[model samples]
Target: MDLNRVVIVGASLAGLRAAETLRNEGFDGEVVVVGAEPHRPYDRPPLSKKLLAGEWEPDRIHLRQPDTFDDLDVEWRFGVAGAGLDPSAGILHLTNGTDITYDGCIIATGAACRRLPEQSRYSHVHEVRTLDDAMRLRAEIADGGRHVVVIGAGFIGLEVAATARQLGNDVTVLEGAPAPLIRGLGEEMGAAIGAMHEARGVTLRCGVQVDRLHDDGVLLAGEDGAEGELIEADIVVVGIGVVPATAWLGDSGLQLRDGVVCDETLNALDVDGSVVPGVYAAGDVLRWPNPLFAEEMRVEHWTNAAEQGAAAAKNLLAAAGRGAGAPEAYAPVPFFWSDQFDIRIQFLGRASADDAVEVVLGSTQPNEDGTVKFLALYRTGDRVHGALGVNAPRWVMKMRGQLMEQASWHDALAHAATLA
Candidate 1:
């Protein structure tokens, strides 16, 4: 197949890596990078941590330096969002009324922050999904004397609450679920993590339903939209969750469930459940079957995005017969880390709430230094399926190999017994 121009629909972490991989993998075609943001790609993890806390400036988070952009030999369409797509016509339509026809396309558009209805009406309400969003929220909380009400008790929400409390602000976190992260880490672990906030002087409210934002703060949803208690706040940050960026592909005929569905090879599937040739996807926007875990997953972690982007690019090249080796399956052990207060939490693998969880090492309580140190393993059937560690980097990371090899549940527990 003759490859000429390849268009990348996102100028994100995944998209940036894809462009780099294409040039490194001997794809000399014209590479065009599309970005909805005018600024260059930057790391997002720090947006909620150091950046929001005013410890790190915007420039420190850039994924690459200035001169590195010129080295890629690619055309960048900044400040232009993908408005539509016609996969059959090999065309990507931008919001600026411009269209580009490409030989191949990589969709790494990522996801959008989900907000409550009429969220944009209030000046105090904000969510951090981009550098601009973080900057705005940072300025609001920089003084740190006012009450900071954070809606949702997820990772982002809790991180922001911790940062706010650290800055001498009165912080309150509200969760609609019975417990924070109950869907991901189970009720017991979720409540365990939630306790960290309460210990640090942050008000943690779970099982609270949010009706809407008022001038005072978050209004609790009452019976049939009746009046309810208003949680007053000087500043409000909403971090409920995100939805995959797939509206641009609404008419593109690509299969969009929770995300873009792909095969084991990361090739985008059409609505009819067939691979759409020359179309590849990665990052939070794409979900593909993993032979390792025997399931399909769309990982939102930065590590997965960075790795999958490179894999997708290489796979696309190999599919077009423009690479050195055959197309390899892009299956990875999804991993992500979070820092809240003084505890560092790291999680790996795909674990369900129903999976039997056991603390393999250390206790789930705070250590002598007032920091958490423990490793919890998720077992399903006969296999050790997932692992989560709190302030136990080495012990937690050691489980990666065990997970990759599909180690037996009892054998994994046996290995941990020796560490004690």
Candidate 2:
């Protein structure tokens, strides 16, 4: 196997980490990282929290500095995207009419924020995903105590609301669902987040549909009937969710079902088997098979991208016989955290599909400083599949190890008793 010419698409968390991991794993090959964004790879997690709160600037979120890429000897190709792929020729077709041949290829193309309906001025509607988006959002919100209408009650929306509130502005969250994060966290757990927002002086309006965005405010129509109420907000932030960035690979022969489909090894599932021999995928774009749940899953967390990128790098090296041993499979516990209005909400594992649940730690007010809540321990008969913790970072971080090691629920319960 020749260790030469590895091309990576999307200079995101996954793409940057993949490049770094390749160099770290002793891959002295020709590495090229292509990004659609003009700027280098940056941390997106803080965009909604610290950056919006005016605590951190846009440039501060950059993960790797200018000199770092040069030090890594990476051929940085910014402001260009991989338009097409010729698998037989082993060439990546760039949008700007540039072609690059590669021995191995990595598709770390991440997701993009789903846009809202068309408006007169698109600048009024904001979505946080990149440094530019965050900067623009922060600038609008910094105009001193202006009302902000946030659509969706997900982590991003809630975080933006928290930031707006911290800046002495009135914030209202309009969630189409009955409760916030009902799909992600079950009704019971999501209600806890809603309760936290209510206690923090943020108005939570559930089961309300946005008719349309007007000059004054959003028209509402739902169980409460149609009301053309003017909430009076300077800007509207929509955090409904994101769609995987894989439309460019439409001609690449890789299976795309809501996202790029991949095997447990992260190899792209090609139609002809030899379509993209050495091509692989990672991060939110790759709907890879998970061993723990025995199902193909797609994770859209920040950590997932970084970790999977490293794993994909190792797998690529293994395919080239440069790795020390067989690369382990990518199976994250699907945990993520959010900091909003002095509340740090954290989850250990996937709480999306839990049927039954129990409050293991704190029932209502678990901790004196803040609310510590842990939800339904996942189990198959008697064995625990995973554990989820809400508003408990230390607990979630601690349980992550247990989830990875397949620690028993009985022991977890025994340990929960000690925390009480």
Q: Output the number of the lDDT-best candidate.
A: 1
Residue range 375-399, candidate 2, lDDT tens digits: 4455554445655666555555666
The lDDT values for all models are: 0.90, 0.79
Location of the lowest summed lDDT over 10 successive residues in candidate 2: 375-384
Candidate 1 wrong stretches, greater than 4 Å: 223-225
Model 2, 273: alpha-carbon shift in Å?
7.3
What is the RMSD, in Å, between candidate 1 and the native fold over all Cα? Answer: 1.2
Predict model 2's lDDT versus the native.
0.79
Q: How much is the lDDT of residue 352 in candidate 2? A: 50
Off by over 4 Å in 2: 119-121, 222-232, 272-275, 366-385, 405-408
Which window of ten consecutive residues has the lowest lDDT sum in model 1? 181-190
Per-residue alpha-carbon lDDT of candidate 1 for residues 1-420, written as tens digits (9 for 90 to 100): 567999999999999999999999889989999999989999999999999999999999999998999999989989999999898888999999989999899999999999899999999999989999999999988888989999988888888998999988999999988888775677778888998779899998998898889998989987777977899999999999899999889999999999999999899999999999999998999989999999878888899999989988998999899987888888788899988888798998976877999987888788787777889999989999888888889888888888898899988898767656
